[model samples]
Target: MRALHPLDFLFLSLEKRQQPMHVGGLFLFQIPKDAAKTFIQDLVADIRLSKSIPVPPFNNKLNGLFWDNDPEFDLEHHFRHIALPHPGRIRELLTYISQEHSSLLDRAKPLWTCHLIEGIEGNRFAMYFKIHHSMIDGVAGMRLLEKSFSQDPQHQGITAPWCVANKRTKRLTDPEAPISKFKKFTNTLQSQLKATPTVLAELGCALKDKKNHHPDYVSSFQAPSSILNQRVSASRRFAAQSFELARLRSIAQHFNVTINDVVLAICSGALREYLLSQNALPKKPMIAMVPTSVRQDDSDVSNRITMILANLGTHLADPLARLSTIRRSVINAKQRFQRMSSDQILSYSACVYSPAGFNIVSGLMPKRQAFNLVISNLPGPKESLYWNGARLDAIYPASIVLDGQALNITMTSYAGKLEVGLTACRNAVPKMQNLLGHLEDEIVCFEQLMTTCNQDSINTMQHTQPS
Candidate 1:
């Protein structure tokens, strides 16, 4: 039994009835052509028989100072099979998942499950994989999905996620409480003392950048109030939309920015439209809390991330202008982030993210907001992936919604497309699906902007030419 890292422990600390701290995904898979009606049944049977073992983080429970395990862990209690009701459409499937995502996970067992869903349309099946955020972050979660699956469609006899994972020799079985609390506290205090200088230097660099009026890094509590900054409810409403990776890449190439920058700009435009329709659009550009992964060698199964507050540029009306502003802001933040190691950055984030704890407990919209919302871009497999003869169509992430931030926008790139998943508090953000339409409109808005900009450049060149 190992001790939970301070960052990983905070997720569990923040967990409550209204806000369940879990990161999940909705996977759509196409069954094999030769598959019989019992395909789903066969899959479920295999999982039920598979032996579940305690993996890192998953095995952890509330120990005295650390997380330990239960002597009696049940596998069946964690895995289940369910089918959609009449009219098994994607929309209906999402509704079921929305309800599934709202409830709290049973802490008595492992904090994860795989619901093998049948009766989906298009001769396909769906799987709703929900795991507590304490166990993994988005990047690690993607790796777990890839590890549990196979590259070959015909690859068979794969065990359930709970049963098997990437083989690691000599699991950490250090009898629980091998280390004393006093020693652990001493080690933590020493590390903080060493990290303080790097943290201060990084802060100095950011301050220097901001003094130049170059918008070095966005500070927390600078967000303008909006509906999205309210305390979230238990009910969640998820909506999704996708665009070809080729198109987004093309736009990125044209604008000379990274794919991630383009994605953030698109979200910024959608949020602008969303809030404007509600007559609550903020006067200043809102803040988007973007998570940056800090994984080194992937030895741990828990979170290794430091978040950056990015300006979403909701204040900019022009799509191209918004993209440019976001590009500069992200670039500046990335420069500062590059100078710090993973541990030093984590220390900095802990200091910065601590302020949001107030809202998490009391659900009171702070006089000053930490950030408006969360936007994450998680990369997926470029090649086609399959699981036991079923073609993996897409993987859309359904991530965590915090107390003050009611909305979360996470996207994953699969094959040649970027599937954007939007999760929000059902009551706080009504008709959340409208954001899908707004996203589509934003993509089109950028395309038109790009074309018009190119034409104007050409006309100016022609007019100024020496004939």
Candidate 2:
């Protein structure tokens, strides 16, 4: 009976025949000798017993639609067991699972799906999980995984946090009962009534908010006559690579910036070089739609989704100057976010960001325009985690790329490594492999700069020291 929040519903509605909006992860684990089968069975059992709770921003009923209400919430409906055919390499397994995860899940069932993959080339196993964009953002999804995993390698006897115990509370089955019906109806009415005034107030505040200005960071919508921006097929192409988290951290420390800032800077430098190579670099600075989570409080569950358009100072040749520009832009954006409530921020994002792109790509409008790309950095488990004594090897995240914005870059840090997953329209970015190289080159560029700065400092110290 509960309704979806306007923003949540918009994300769900953006999914059309061609494009499916979902965020997913591919997890690699080393299977222990005796516990592989046991781990799989226990994982299935845990998913079956787990119950999904309603979170804010969506009505309880609407939030429950994908989990509690859907008959396909059962384990067999969402979780599947698969074995790779002969000559199973990591590339083959990842490619197969990526395509599977890209397909739309049944709307009539839970809005999530998981594939437990076994019998790969070695002792390694893989798990691929896809959840509807409406259900959880990347940060919340990471939290769920952290909660499910054990910190200790020898940990046993404790079920995943998502698992239901034998004495768990059971949901009522009789929907037609007077008390049940009344409570549902009353809750729906109350939610709607509460949202009405809040929506109006947000609109009023948005009018007064000058930070909502849309900077023209890219060229005017010229209907890019490219294969990438056109209608997409249901099929998808996913690529991933990993780098040492310590290396990135070292770069960040050397530059006096956060790890995320370094990441964005690297993307900026790479994209700049890539575009220059194509001779298609835009004159103005390109803007990135950076999605920032607002789940600051523990009690809150997936409450916030806001975006800031970041100006990637690709025009700046100096790495330090580019980092300084990015730092300033991010600081200004964070200050703006601080001034707004969580509801107001999400509402503003939907109104300013989501609609134009959705409408244009959905073919509702002839010339819909928005930011050029999406760059998301989602935090993952800091410590190494295990599944039934098998050490997790790698965790990679794949995100959605819409028609206009033909590229999506999502990064997650897990097990002291920064895993970067790049999903792009295959035709749009034909030489996507170059990006991996570009990322490496940018990192090296930053390191070189750091080394120069350090040697200069050493020379200055030696000159000042008594001879």
Candidate 3:
């Protein structure tokens, strides 16, 4: 058995019944024409027989000092096939997933499950696959998802994530190694000692930038508490919607902003409207904890992220202004991030996410004033993917929410559409479904801003023309 990473262990040790720490994905597929009624059954059989399981993350379970796993795992315990209740619309599918997402994964077994859900409207079926956050991050999870799919639609021998076979016979990392506090302390001390120069250099740069009075530093804890900062419940409500990727690309191209900046602006506008309806708008721009992927191409299934605080510009009424501010803030943050090494990134990220663990250890919850919420963006396959023979329609990412952080917005751009999944505490974020509508409204408003600004510029050009 291998030892779980300290960061991953933090997720396990701090998990409460009320706060399930996991990330999930919902994939909707169009059932291929001429498929047999027993197609799903056949697919299930294939998965159960596939025999290869990924290690370090997928097959691990708590075993006192470290993680342990069964050499021959029971596949049936991890996979379930469910039929939607009668009149199985998309709404029913989401309701089923929301409930399941709230419940903790069974620790007695593997920390993952796949539900092959049928009975949805149209010639379609959906998969709600969930793995504990300790097992994977969103980026690695996305890559893992490709295991079940095939580039060739007609490829008959595809293996699902659970049964995906490991081809190589080489030994993986030694998970049975002893872990000690003294060793941990020494390792940390060494890393810190090495990072000291980097820290001093960063501080000097900050001081130098302060002398220059840079306008883009977004410090944390500057946000006002709203209804979102209240205590969360054990219940979860998930909402999924898709927007045309071209629309976002068009806006980003027109504004010369990154797609992430556009996403932040959209969220800023949506939260602004959502909170306003409850008469809970904060006078100051809200602070958002945005997790940036720091993983290299060859990184393993661990979470390598840098958490950056972003000014969502909620106080601003104008969409353009919010977009501009988000763009500038993100650009500045990225520049600063690029200056740091991997060790520094981990140090900064640990400092950023440490409070939740501390609060749990203290038998307290996070305060609403700590931060507003989480917003993440993960990129996905550009071309269409097929599972067995069914064409993949959409892939919506379902993410985690903490005690004081009531809501999460995770968007994945799959194929030509951007699928957004909003996960929130059912009690804390009432009518969280309305945020989807607000997001669409903001997109329209931004389009109008582009139109109006273009017209105004044209008018100025005409007025300044020489006779």
The TM-score leader among the candidates is 1
Write down the TM-score of every candidate.
Answer: 0.92, 0.79, 0.89
TM-score of model 1 (CA atoms):
0.92
Candidate 1 overall Cα lDDT vs. reference?
A: 0.80
Top candidate on lDDT is 1
Evaluate model 2: give its lDDT: 0.66
lDDT of 2 by residue, 1-467 (tens): 33354545666777875578888888888877777457766765755565653222111224342224542235566668888877878788867865775688676655677788876777788888887787667776776677667788887654533342121112222244344545666775665555555556654554554344423222223223322344555667787889988888998776566888789889989888887788776665666778898766542233357776666777778766566666666766675557666755665555555556566545665334455678898888889998757788889888887766777889999989999888876666767757878999998888887767665643442233111
- What ranking of all candidate models by lDDT puts the best one first? 1, 3, 2
* Reference-based lDDT, each prediction: 0.80, 0.66, 0.78
Task: Tell me the TM-score of model 3.
Answer: 0.89
Of the two candidates 2 and 3, the one with more favorable TM-score, higher being better, is 3
Question: Could you tell which candidate, 1 or 2, scores higher by lDDT?
Answer: 1
